[model samples]
Target: MKQQSEMILIGGGLIGLSLAVELKLRGATVTVLSRNQQEAAGLVAAGMLAPQAEQIPSGPMLDLCLRSRALYNDWTRKLEEMTGLETGYWPCGILAPVYERPDCTTLPQTPETPSYWLERDAILHQQPGLGNDVVGGWWFPQDAQVDNRRGLIKTLQTAAQELGVTIIEGITVEKIVTSPDQKVTEVQTNQGIFRADHYILTTGAWSGELLSIPVYPRKGQMLSVRVPDDFKSLPLQQVLFGSNIYIVPRRDGLIVIGATSEPVGFTTGLTPQGVETLLSDAIRLYPILKEFPIQEFWWGFRPETPDLFPILGPSSWDNLTLAVGHYRNGILLAPVTAQLIANWVLNAQTDPLLHHFRSDRFQTLR
Candidate 1:
């Protein structure tokens, strides 16, 4: 019998955990190392699978987003089956209210997602909670969301555990050791040295520390507010996208409001200005939000690349593969990224899309 390929995954975020499960399902022996699972931004994301709502014009990133959004249904279903847990995968769609006519300009459209302009009356009829200040807006029926913090992570971690994938938490990988031939052979961590046949990096913002990648932290401050009992109407049933902020409603009566994009470089702190801007923008989208009590305030650093696109597939090192630099779309792109990486590792074949996300792109540009 052929020996199972042993793979070491650095970073147990949604991407790393999901990749571990995928590799295990493909008959590989996988071990995942996470410095701090709770610190992962994946747990804090509002989980908007809005390829059309957050369109990337026309490029490889758009292709990746749409493909991953298409897989959420099946992915969540399989996860639910394996873990018997609800992933809170909601296909309730997204509503982008146009507070001003200029906000509607350059509204994105995609062939796969069904999007249309809703008139002012139609907008109110669809989601009656919005403020009268809103005019018309774009509605994306194909867009969906999940509860990443509580729902998605629970299912993923449970599923991975049940699949016999080993996950070691609170273990920080200090550096990756490569052979003289430029092939990754082992990883040195705070806990100990671990050797594996293959090494996969999904360390998000910390990717630069392990490897000389251009990945950096793009800090985002977010808050969640609980729905009040005296509210006149039901909680928001769809995501609200306004000028520069978005309000995502949870099934459990909490609205997730976010975020401010600041390049603060690994620094952590919630600023008053950030929170105020979020509240101001959210209230402008729906005046009723003022009645809700603030439930949580937190921040996460998104792994950003120079081009703002993910660095996927093989890296410059022979046995090292990259699955980082997803920025704001990490949660949205987790499923397909896992599938593609697992497929490439198992088959040893190059995927055509790998060309677009190669980690050596910056070096080539130099």
Candidate 2:
């Protein structure tokens, strides 16, 4: 029998864990090295699968987000079956409401997109929890969400481990050693040196520290609150988005409100201003938030790129691949990314989407 290829993945975040599971299912021996499994932004994210709502001015990212959103249903379902864990996959759609009329001016009008401009009466009829401040809203019926804490962090970890993928927590890769021909050979880590035939860098924000890449930390602060007993069953059935804040309702009677995007590098402090902004905006959208008890407050660094799009696919090194720089949409894009990276490693097939997210796309700009 031919020996299974050895794959060492650097970074145990959502992307890394998903890739590990995908590669392992393809019969490769995969191992994941992470600094600390608890610190990834994927855990802190609100897990909103809003593709049209998070659309950039214009780019391939929206298309990519939509593609991943389509795969989420099957992906989470399979993960649940494999690990027997509830991933908190909620297909309850998203509502992007604006307090002022100007906020609705930039809503996209793509022919194939399933968004509708909702008037005040229609918005209130659909969701009665809104405050009078909401003038209008954009409804994306296809967008969905998952509980990152349970669905992604715990679920992905459980699924990866069940698939025979070794997860080394609290380990750091100091350097990646490649052969003279630019093929990855081994990684020197805090624990020891580990060799593998293939290396995947899914280190997200800290990706630049290990590889020569442009990934940076975009800090985001978020908070969660417990829904009152009366609202526990339904507690805002859909995700509500305002100017800079978004409100996500979990199935377990907890509502997640977030987040402030600060360009401060790698700093993980929750500022008074950040918390104040999130609560104030959240309460503005739904007055009932003031009656709820605070659940949690935290922050995480989003792995961002210059173009605000993710970098996926192989790097210059033949045996190394780059799956970092997912930014705000990492949770939404994880499944598709895992599939593409695994396909490339197992069959050397390049998905068309990889062209838009190549690691070296910015070489011509310099």
lDDT of 2 by residue, 66-177 (tens): 7889999999999999999998999998998877776445466666567888889988887887888898888888889999876677888988888889888898889888
TM-score of each candidate structure, all chains considered together: 0.94, 0.95
Q: What C-alpha lDDT, on a 0 to 100 scale, does residue 76 get in candidate 1?
A: 94
The alpha-carbon deviation from the true structure for residue 340 of candidate 2, after best TM-score superposition, in angstroms, is 0.6
TM-score of 2: 0.95
Cα misplacement distance, residue 268 of candidate 2 (Å)? 2.2
Residue pairs in clash, model 1: none
Off by over 4 Å in 1: 1-5, 102-111, 230-233
Model 2 bad stretches (over 4 Å): 1-5, 102-112
